[model samples]
Target: MTNREKYNQAFIETLEITADQLGDDLTYQSIEAWDSVGHMQLVSALEDAFDIMMDTDDIIDLSSYPLGIEILKKYDVEFS
Candidate 1:
């Protein structure tokens, strides 16, 4: 699968959310399933899916979907 597809799938699986439910507005604290545990799961999932380990700064900055994409891009992950 593509990077976007993998990211979307990881989000869905880790957060137990639907594709339609993912967006900038759907932040970590905004969703029921996006708690601390889910946040770590998402980080792990994204790392595994993209084969890139994230730094603490990136992890802290990944507070939203858009931020996650940006963070992945910093690791040389092409979204398209």
Candidate 2:
């Protein structure tokens, strides 16, 4: 899967949401499913999916779906 697909899948699995429900507008606490607990789950899922350990700052800075791409790019994760 491409990086975009992997990113979406991480959110899908971690947030227990459908793919159709995800978007750039999707942010932390934007939905009931993306609460504090869900945020950490997403962090873990993204780490597992991308095979990289994110710094605490990056993890905390990942406040939105679009921001995720930017943050992941710092780890050399390219999106297509």
Number of the top lDDT candidate: 2
lDDT of each prediction vs. the true structure? 0.89, 0.92
lDDT of 2: 0.92
lDDT of 1 at 75: 92
Q: Tens digits of per-residue lDDT for model 1 on 1-80?
A: 88899989999998888899978797878887888888999999999998889999888888999889988999999987
> For candidate 1, what is the TM-score?
0.95
Between which residue pairs do clashes occur in model 1?
none
RMSD (Cα, Å) of model 2 = 0.8
For residue 44, give model 2's deviation from the true position in Å.
0.5
